[model samples]
Target: MDCEILENTVLLAIVTLISVVQNIFFAFKVENESKIANSKSSQKTSSPAFDKVYTANQNCTDAYPTFLALLWCAGIFCSQGPAAFAGIMYLCVRQKYFVGYLGENTQITPGYIFGKRVVLFLFLMSMAGILNYYIGVFFGSDVKMYIKAVSNTVSPFLLIP
Candidate 1:
């Protein structure tokens, strides 16, 4: 199979790993906080640690669908390499955001900012790629030719398996 055919699967696996890490981190932190609070349940706790972990987890949960949509759309319509790079960066920043939020809320700023920018970039790329495809379909422009040329130029350097 061509590597291009597997781009979405690779991206999905990366996203799933990031999500699993976040969930595990949240579970461990909340469990530890529960122990310190002398409670068996951390849910709805007033402890600062629980609050931070819950907030971080909730933020990621809220943003996850949108991120996945943009990532997949961009990867499908645009080239895989840039989409994969941005997806990895977004995942890394999410990890940073989780860790930073645990320390100081203000420390999350860098990750938050970068993550937002990456999402925006993915959105733009998706729009451009989709528009290009439709234009080719509607106007008989050789979109595949253009995409093939660009891919041929870039794919050799990407070296995806």
Candidate 2:
């Protein structure tokens, strides 16, 4: 193909690589946290080590989405910029909630949790709206359909945030 096309292909490859590596990181975080949470639950005192699970892990919200990002990025050769951006953006959104709301893994503070959740919801919804609008045009689909597709694609990335 042309030089511009070659450059785009390379850029897309890089983006996809980043997405997969991010997924691996998410998986490790969740797996590690699960082990720690299980072990800590059995104990009387909540140890710092136990807390480490949440604090250290990115709360592993978007693992599935990250994986999907990797897959989709691969299929499109990174041509689907909206999808890739959504995947990564969703992960970031997840981390904020995971840390702000789900941290400490205690009975969540309801007020704090609700507030954080509302914020996250608004944020993601706005992003989904944007993707739905623009990408929808390209795909010759409705906003709702595009939104659904993008949202579904990034579902795995939807961290508890």
What overall lDDT goes with each candidate model? 0.73, 0.50
lDDT, residue 103, candidate 2: 52
Query: Residue 135, candidate 1: how far off, in angstroms?
Result: 0.7
TM-score attained by model 1: 0.74
- C-alpha root-mean-square deviation, each candidate: 5.5, 9.5
Which parts of model 1 have CA positions greater than 4 angstroms off?
1-4, 7-21, 31-45, 143-161
For this target, which candidate reaches the highest TM-score against the unseen true structure?
1
TM-score versus the correct structure, for each prediction: 0.74, 0.35
What would the per-residue lDDT of candidate 1 be over residues 1-161, giving only the tens digit for each residue? Answer: 78857754676567657766866876777677667765755565567777787788788778988888887787778766676777777887888888999898689998888788878877876786788899889997757446535543653432231
| Pairs that collide, model 2 | 61-159, 62-157, 64-156, 65-156, 65-157
- Model 2, stretches more than 4 Å misplaced? 1-3, 41-91, 104-161
lDDT for model 2, on a 0 to 1 scale?
Answer: 0.50
Which pairs clash in the backbone of model 1? none
| Model 2 CA lDDT for position 14 | 60
